[model samples]
Structures are given as structure tokens and as C-alpha cells.
Target: MAATGTARTAVDSVMAQLSALEDPKMRAVNERHGDDYGVNLSRLRAVAKELKTQHTLSVQLWQSGDTAARLLALLICRPKSFEQDELDAMLRESRSPKVQDWLVNYVVKKSPHAEELRLRWLSDPDPVAASAGWALTSERVSKSPEGVDLSELLDAIEVDMRDAPDRLQWAMNTCLAQIGIAHPEFRNRAIGIGERLEVLKDYPTPPNCTSPYAPIWIAEIVRRQAGE
Candidate 1:
């Protein structure tokens, strides 16, 4: 959608706000993750609050190519109006893992076409699409599992996980943990798969955070949920 003159002015104002709050140190950190923004999340949200017209401004900001602005744009964009081609373009252009995560959670998952995209992208050869597909599946299993085939998911995890790309591996591991925690009937089976895969078994985890190692993470979550 083309931004009107007034909308362009509003976008420019918001960009100015973001630029004023930019932090060089934060920008350096973001650069490590492939994002080119110097602005912090809090500052971006502050700008988002000031610019209430999300849909209009999102279009302009997304076109600006500023990392912070694009993140804000995703927050304000109308999920229902988001098209598949636009989403595909965003995913293709996303180099930062953080941006991809926001796109999956804030935009794609909230869209009306989420399930359709999820099913199609899960098998897509592109790593970005496939990773988003797995991430969406993980979210679905956490909230609702009515139609999802647990058996099929488990089978895929068993067969494809070791050979999956880095991003998809993380999502698959999370999916395994979600299944174990959300469906008690599948807890043992999920645990067995985790044991066999040993995914993230040797990966370091920060203190106070659950290890991404599926078996340990699943067991810890299950224990806590059971009031242990």
C-alpha cells in the first residue's frame, strides 16, 4: 500500500523518535545478530505507542530497511491484511534470527492463513519457511492439539531432527518438549524420543533457564506442572 503524504510524515516522525533513542552499544550487539538497529526494544515500543496507526505506518517503516523500524512495523501491521507474498518476501529478506522469530510469532501466527502456511511450509525446502513452519507447529501444540497428529509429529522428529537445519532443530526440540508437557499421554513417548535423539544434550544453558536438551527440559517441565 502506498503511504499518503501525511502517513509519510508520521512515519518520518516516528523514525526520528527511534533515531533519538539509538544506543551505539546496543546497535553493536544487534549487528552481531545481523540486525542493523541501534535502538532498543523499549524505545521501539515507545515509538509504537506514539504512532497508533500501525497498519499505515508499518508499510512505510518496512520499506525503510531500518532494523528497529521494521521490528516496530511488524508489531503494528494488521495480521489479517498481511498477504502470503508479503510474508514470503519478509522471510526471504530476514537475516536476523530475532526478526524471523518476531515474524513467526507476531505476524504469521496471528494471521488468518497461519495453518495453511504452516502445513505448506513445514515441508518447504527453504530453511526459513521450514523453520517458521516448525515454530508455528510448536505454538499450535502448546495451545491446541485437537487435529494435530501426535504420532506423525513424533515420527518426523525421530527421523528428521538430527539432519534438520539449525533453526528447525531448535523448533523441533521445543515441539518435543511442548508435546510432553501439554499431553500427559504422550509424555513417556516424547521422553523416549528425546532420550534417543539426545538433542541439545551437550548444549550449554544459562543458569536459571531450562536446558534445551529435550529430555531434561521435558522432565523438568512435567515435574513442575505436576506440583513436584
Candidate 2:
């Protein structure tokens, strides 16, 4: 469906708000991450909240191709309204890791077809789709592991993680950590896999920050859960 006149007007207003709030420093930071626009999340969200329109305005804003506008579009887009092809297009168009992460976390995971897409994309040749699939799988593992085959996921991580694409490798590592934390049946095996893979083990985490190193992250969460 095409955006209506009202949607166009809302898009214009949002663009104006974004322009008014532009920060060169923030833009530079965003550019470093593949975004070209300067609007911050807080400001964009405030504008979205003020507009009180989600899908229609989101469609228009996404078409505008402003980095912040596209991010906001992800925030407001109706997940159910988007087809798998459209979601794939969005992933392909996402130039930065942040946008891709937001698309997975905010829009794709919320879709009614999330599980279907997750499974379909898991083995997809496209790196972005595969990475998103793993990310979605990780979210599922965290929220609801009852139906997931923990053994199968572990096998895939063990076999393919080392050679996977960069983003997919990150997601696979996260999936390993999530499996360890969320599924007691596979906790030991997950930790073992993490220790063997040694993924992100030397990534240098700051003080008081939990390392993304699967072994450490899993151990900490498991320890916390056990009240140790």
C-alpha cells in the first residue's frame, strides 16, 4: 500500500524535527557505524511518540532513506504487515550493524512469522539473513526454549561457527551463551563448546561490564541464577 497524503505530511514533520535536533558529533558517531544522519534515538523516539503513528508514517520515513528515519521506521513498522521478502530487503538495505541489530530485535522478532522466518533464514546463504536468523534464534532460546532443539543448535555451532561470517559468528556465540544460560540440560555442553571455540575470550571488556566471551558470560549468568 502506498503512503497517503497525511502520511507524507507526518513524514515531513518528522524530518523537520530530526533536522532541528541534528548533532554533528552524533552524526559522526553514527557515520562510524554506517549511519549518515545525526538524530539520536531518544530524540527520534520522542518524535515518534509525539506523532503517534506507527506503520503509515514508518513506511513514508523508510522511503525517505534518512538513517535516523529508517531506524525510527523499524521502531514503528507493523511486523505483521511486513512479508518475508520485505524483511529480507530491509536486512539487505541495512548498511550498519546497529540497524541490522535493531531490525532483528525490534521488528523481526516481533513479527507473527518470526519463528518461520528464523528457521528459513538460519541456513540461508546470505550472511545478513543467516546472522538475523541466529539472532532471532538466540532471542527464542532466551524467551522460550521448550520447542527448540538444543542439541541441534549446539551441533551447528560446533561445526560452522569458526568459519561463519563475522556477524553470524557473533550471533552464533550469543546463541551459545543463551543456550547455556537458559537451558539447564545443555549448560555444561554449551560452556564446553564456548571454551573450545574461545570466541570473544580476549575481546577486552571494561570494569563492571560482563564480557561477551561465552564461557565467562555463561558462567556468570549461571552462577547468578544459582545464587552463588
Candidate 3:
């Protein structure tokens, strides 16, 4: 009873703090990314720092269904404490790009079920889930290429990337770039596929930032790795 009561108090207190931090202009900017709240990451991190890790409080915040609260929940929660299905449900429930990105990066990556979920998500018809799969695959491509079928990944990217939805397309492009950057064998093929697909070819990249265009992205990262 004491633990439960503490969880409730924590949830209520954090919710109020989150409400006080809301900003209309920030929300307007976040809305472009499908997020509804405006508390910037620095402020959000400060909030998380105070709360520390609290799984029950995180669950309540996630249940509240506010984007900023969900982001905060992700930061303050114990990542590997969640069950596989719970993580899957959270990812699906995450409507905002920020929420989904945070879940995958901060939570799922740390979960014991990561590989199982990664394989399942890769074939999921939902673009967001599929994007998660690709994102995980990119990690594997860079870190553990022993068993991954790099050629098959490239073949799929070649056939599907040009017409993938916005978020999925970006994820697929990242995987393609990762393959080229990590493996010398597939570098030429990945670059050729990116050049042909022209994915993110004309993206409005800010000056001094690496372009997301996969070929350029791949080339630049590789150049830096070689101390060029």
C-alpha cells in the first residue's frame, strides 16, 4: 500500500510539473513531428533527473497518453524491466515520432527481447513497426554482421525504399547507409542502390550538416572514418 501510494503521488506530481512546462510555440514545432507537447529535451532531462528511475510511475505517465509525459516516462523508467509484449504495445501506442524513437532507442534497445522483437517488427505491416525493425537492423549491421543477410537487406531496400512512407523510408535509408559504412563488400552496391532510388536526394539539409541522402551520408561517414 505504501509503494502504491508513492507511485500515485509521483505520477500526479510529475504530471503537474509537465503541465507547467508546456509551451505553445514549442508545441507548434513539435506538432510537425506529430508530438503534442513542447517541453524541450534539456528541461525534460532535468525533470527525469529529479524523479530518477520509477517503473510504476512511468507506467502511469504512459497511460496518461500525453506525448511529453510519455517521453518523460521513457526517460525515468527502467528499460529492461518491461515485458516483451508490453514493449510491443508501448511502441504501437506511441503515435508521436519522438515517443516511438525514444521507446526504441532508450527502452527496446536495452530489453532482453530486443532480437525477438526486432525480427517480429521487421515484417510488421505497420510503417512505424517496420521502421523500428529497420532501425534495429541498422544496429545489427554495424555491430554484428556475422549472421545478417546483408545482400537480402540491400535487395529489399532497392525494391521498396523508393515508395516507402516518410518515416519508414528514412529508416530504410539509414539501414542502407549503415550497410555501406560498415561492410566493404556491400559498399558499392549500397551506394548504387541509394543513387538509383534517390531517396532523400533533395532533402533540405542545413549547411554544415551531413545530408541524409544515403550515398552522400555513406561517403561522408566513411571519409571521416578514414581520417579524411
Q: Give TM per candidate.
A: 0.92, 0.91, 0.97
- Using alpha carbons, what is the TM-score of model 3? 0.97
Candidate 2 vs 3: which has more lDDT: 3
lDDT by residue for model 3 (1-228), tens: 998898788788888998899888999998886788888789999999988988888889999999889999999899889999999999998889989999999999999999999999997999999999999999999998778999999999999999999999999999999999999889999999999999999999999999999999999999999998
Q: What C-alpha lDDT, on a 0 to 100 scale, does residue 41 get in candidate 3?
A: 82
- TM-score, prediction 2: 0.91
User: Please, what are the lDDT tens digits per residue for candidate 1 over residues 1-228?
Assistant: 354777878878888888898999988988886778788787677767776657867988888877788889888888789888888788878777777889889899888888988898888888878888888899889997879998899999999998888888988889989998898899899999999988899998899999998888988988887798
Off by over 4 Å in 2: 1-5
Candidate 2, residues 60-82, lDDT tens digits: the string is: 78888777788788877787898
Model 2 residue 80 distance off true place after TM-score fit, in angstroms: 2.3
RMSD values, in order shown = 2.1, 2.2, 1.1
